[model samples]
Target: MSKIALFGPTALELFGHTVHAPLQRRAITSERAAEFTPSKRVLDHVHSTFPFLSRPAHITVFDRKHRRQKYARCHLGTPALLNFDFLHVGDGILAPPPEVALVQAMRGRSVIQAAAQGSALCASYSLHADSPTIIQREPIATRASLEMVTRSCSSIPGCKTVRNALPWILPHAASPREIALGLVLFLPVRLGGYGLPRPTLNFPIPTGKHPGNLADRRYYVADLCWPHAHLIVEYDSDAFHLTSDQHYHDIVKRTTLESMGYHVITVSRRQLNDPSEMDKVAACIAKALQKEWRFRVRDFPTRQTQLWTILGLAPNR
Candidate 1:
């Protein structure tokens, strides 16, 4: 059986399981510290194998039974590290897989917090992943691995939020802002989301520039596109888009796309500061959808949250 250890930021970083978005960690209070020491045998094994972790910070491991011991105190009910893909961190000693560590790292937190962390993990490899601090060196979780982790999260209680948020976490989101934009638009209004259909990310459209000339052919990659809705949304970063040359090019690109019958909407960081502003943003998209095609919004999937049921949350409640 895989050995379970004390889960914390140091262990996660050592295992390379950081996220692009920020989430809360369960603070280790003095009371929790008594149960937080690593087994001498496990400590020796880890030190012998991965000495770098020892230098940066002290390591901790606890008997798996300690998980049940703190059913009420730890609240997260022992870090969920079962059947995890152990990484061979040199020597024979193994570390928890990045995906598993992510789940464990957010243990004892609310569903939204956990899902936000998971969303950051899901978006890590997307074209727009974001982290204010150092760049992560470990590989992000793949779709398959993410799906596996989502399923496994059900084994823990109060994880419905994480499962519910999975469908909204797109792997193609170019950045955290873009993900925020899409979620703002696609998530149900009741959840403080726009309640619209999911939009495509980094959608590629042929620009028809030198089409036959393979070398000179060009394409306009829309940040968020809904082909059927004929709507495109872009989150503009001043640092990236304010240059004179870039501004001129953007005008030409938008003109070309508009001429092709695509309605483009550009949003800035300032605009997304609050719910009222985001509501106005969604209104703009809704108005465009109505004016362009006269198509009605599809019936919202009320049961879009069956995964919550899988996670032992009541569907009716």
Candidate 2:
């Protein structure tokens, strides 16, 4: 087995197994990296073999000896070098386990982006694939697994980032857009969300008793649900949701939930794109939950803007 484990964004790209976005890695992945630590000559030999490791983006690796190089950003000490875990994806190329890879991936990511990634790790689908449709797989890791690793590395800087990230994590989130909605709505008010209580993503409510459920759909899965409040917020993504048949399906689902005495709220991509519109939607939901939705912070606007930047929801200047 190769000891040249990929770390950082290079790992993330190969699934540091994170997201669906295009990854133009500036870092390197060397098969010869297995023999990287013996000497300068060995390292040079290893590095030279991978002519394709020419990307300009930084990729992290374990290099305590601190050998100088163009692309590798070495993690000299702490967890990445000593305590983290790894697994083989294929071809004898070892990769840091999901929990470890996620910890490494968070180094350069904004808070919301990292939270989404962490949550995605707990999900049951693969974001990295050649097909447009996300494929189903056993969850690569769990919130508990991440927590275990984070606690083990508490003294490390990345651990604190992971700690800060815990509050916003929605372990059951199903899509990137769903993650965006959860962060914007449930993240603390200081972090640019409305400060709503965290909701369970894709919570299943049994409809087995309702005879009117003639469609034989046995469960109504809420995109974001506050079970205690019986409130659900559904994200109607712009993709595949604009069709007439999908619109009818949504109407039926909303009516079905309302009939069951649950308050249903819908958030569309357009509303999420426009902050003012989203605020109105938040207000409507808050009214349903009997919570006052108001901001008292003086720099709230600037902070929320930064949050937008973090979420990649802000428009380009």
The C-alpha RMSD of each candidate to the native structure, in angstroms, is 10.1, 5.9
lDDT on C-alpha atoms for all candidate structures: 0.54, 0.66
> On residues 227-278, what C-alpha lDDT tens digit does candidate 1 reach at each position?
9988999788563648887777777778778777789999877665444465
- In the range 1-317, model 2's lDDT, one tens digit per residue, is 22344555555555523343222222223433434343334334334543333243233345555445544555543433454434544333445666766777676566776687787777656653444466555566678888888877665556667767876788876776787888888888777788987789889987656656633366888999999999999988674647887777777778778878789888988888777788889899888888977898888777777777777685322
Collision pairs in model 2: 11-16, 12-16, 26-56, 26-57, 27-57
Task: Summing lDDT over every window of 10 consecutive residues in candidate 2, give the lowest-scoring window.
Answer: 20-29
Please report how far candidate 2 places residue 48 from its true position, in Å. 16
**TM-score leader:** 2
The number of clashing residue pairs in model 2 is: 5
Worst 10 residues of 1 by lDDT: 69-78
TM-score of each: 0.61, 0.80
Instruction: Give me candidate 1's TM-score against the actual structure.
Output: 0.61
